[model samples]
Target: MSQWFQLGLQNGNSPLMEQLTFFHDHALLIVVLITSIVTFFLSAIFVNKFLHRYLLDGQMIETIWTVLPALILIVIALPSIRLLYLIDEINNPALTLKVTGHQWYWSYEYSDFNDIQFDSYMIPTNELEQGMYRLLDVDNRVPLPFNQPVRLMITSDDVLHSWAVPSFGIKMDAVPGRLNQSSLMINLPGVFYGQCSEICGAGHSFMPIVVESISSGEFLKWLESQI
Candidate 1:
């Protein structure tokens, strides 16, 4: 199962996106597992008591209604809280990238490098490929090494915008005068696509994000090209 999880996405080229897709696809399984156990027992109790009971909407029914929902909430809260905290915690990251949300585009700067910066804009519709999505391509691609930990610092040049790449399990707000951070670790080499999530202006939908994950050697070559 772990081996299968490492496979790249059929629609996307990124391995990180594939893992996120799997996580999204299996998310309902967790819901099903918990709901099945809780609902089955609860339904059984409801049917056995309500269908054959002597009274309807009585004191016993009222008491069961109040207590049953609270009990179910407790069961659901345990797992939900654990996942929330886990997502918030940041481990040691190998490198960092700074992303700034501009008025109609995005700028990424490599903090680990010599602050190599580039602007990413939307790909013109005429320039799009068969498999490529328009408004999701960029003029520049952020390059990083495969199978490495990377930290991202996000901020805004104008209004607020959200840097969200669903495949990377990253969504950080880019607020004016403030910086937000997130981290990612890709286990394979490929191009991952994302877009500016917040609605800052008319061109908000046009601002796309493309991240190129390459081999360590290839990443170095790309970095040298930037210089």
Candidate 2:
């Protein structure tokens, strides 16, 4: 979860998010390097007493400017393409969780188990308990076993709503009459929070999403109770 004065992005709980964090740092470093080089040249142009006419027109400078950006793009594009493919690949998922977004709330279904499904509605601020996160907590949470890959299928009931969780690096749109799917694995065990990113209605901010990640043994116990 993100907190006040957080320096960088929230801790990544999924493998894909970890890769995303790495890619962010990698790209930022390149941008910083480019900025530093440009700044140094601009400073020299103003402060330095020496001036050369050849500096303004040169094939070497043009080649450097052109090839450098292309090379940098290739360097960044390779990893980006790999991550896209990785997110798309769903390998033998241990479970398939179906999600549907309504005008305000979210519904989840565990098709791998028999008749296990529920609606998750946000807990009102006035009804919140001590130590509970106001406007972020929900009456029901989508529970899943940690360290196991799961395939998520999403759709919408009425309007467009986006199911987003920052830690999991997932933000799938819930479009009516259309379905979207993604693969992810929670590497850590904890409760993660999100909300309906799209403005479906007036209650958009009140529609929150929660996920509780636990071990497989505890998940089985929860399944037994649900059954």
Candidate 3:
């Protein structure tokens, strides 16, 4: 169950997500510092009657303001650009999974193995067992191996949908007649949950995504059973 007072992002389960969280904190710190400084200056002007006659027509002040913002942007931009490239980098994935979004459910295909495919549907609330998460658990959970690179090819069979998992830091659009791809690597073994980000139709919220990361040997055993 999700906590009621959760304030920040979910604990990351992947390396990319860890980096994303770090970047978020880094950017937020800069914003907070800028806001605090600006607020202090404005308060001083009003409260302390601190007014400089040359403030309005000072070239040095204008130059300093302009240069400072430019430098801050550069500081922010460098890491942002690096993260963008890192997310796009595909380093020879060990497994490839094709995901197709339907009007409500999600279908997954393991192309690396022979004849391995399934459809994942949300388990109704009433049918949920003990310890099952409401509206988050699914009938078919996608199994993946920890520490193994995996590639996902996303598309839609009917309407537009988005495949996203916050802990994995992945959100790719699923458009009909178009295949969008993304790569991910789970750093640990656990169950991560996500939902279709795009608002498709009446049942948009019913389609939930669940990924179960296990050991490579266990993943192979599951794959063999599927075949």
Candidate 4:
């Protein structure tokens, strides 16, 4: 969840999200270093009005410029590639969850369990209780146990939509007639919020996503109740 005036990424609740945050910080540091160095050099040249044709165009300087960017890109690309494989690696999920996007709502199916499915709709403002977040609360929140890997399958019944939960580091598109897959394993217990990221129709902003991360025992209780 985010606070007022907050612009940074949300604190991670999953291992993948935590790794993503680390990568973001790592890349940001390198970017700032490059920007600062470039700015200083430009400022020095402009302030002194110094011009040395041979010194500026030296072979050593050219080689350094070319090799430095390549090194930086390699440094960035390695981790990115590793993370991509990690995210795509869905090995023997403990459970399977299917998410279906509609024009104005979402449907969830716990495929591993029998008769556990429901449609999630946004809680209207007039029906909201005290302390409930507006435009983020749903009538039925998808509950899954923490520390358990779940295979997430996403698809759309109608137009394009996106199922994104920032704290969980999930943002998979829901395409019609095609299924996209992802994985989620929350490391903590909390209620995470999200919304339909793609603009589908008039109710695009009204379709909110809520996920309840709970202990295995509590999750079993909820599962039993749902079943």
lDDT of 1 by residue, 1-227 (tens): 11246653344233445545655456566678768977987888767744645334488878877898787677656656665565565688778899999988989888877858888888899998788766777778888887777878999989999997766667788999998877677766777877888899998888888888888888888889888
Candidate 2: deviation at residue 12, Å?
Answer: 0.5
Best by lDDT: 3
Query: Which sequence of candidate numbers ranks them by lDDT, best first?
Result: 3, 4, 2, 1
For each candidate in turn, the TM-score is: 0.74, 0.97, 0.97, 0.97
- Model 3 is weakest, by summed lDDT over 10 consecutive residues, at 48-57
The digit string of per-residue lDDT tens for model 2 on 152-194 reads 9999999999999999888889999998999889998999998
Q: Give the clashing pairs for model 1.
A: none
Candidate 3 has an lDDT of 0.94
- Model 4 agreement with the true structure over 46-153: per-residue lDDT tens digits: 897668886567998898889999999999999899889988989899989999999899999999888889999999999999999999999999999999999999
In terms of TM-score, how similar is model 1 to the real structure?
0.74
Question: Model 4 residue 198 lDDT?
Answer: 99
| lDDT per residue as tens, model 3, 45-64 | 88975568677678898999
Worst 10 residues of 1 by lDDT: 8-17
After superposition, the stretches of candidate 4 with alpha carbons farther than 4 Å from their true spots are 49-54
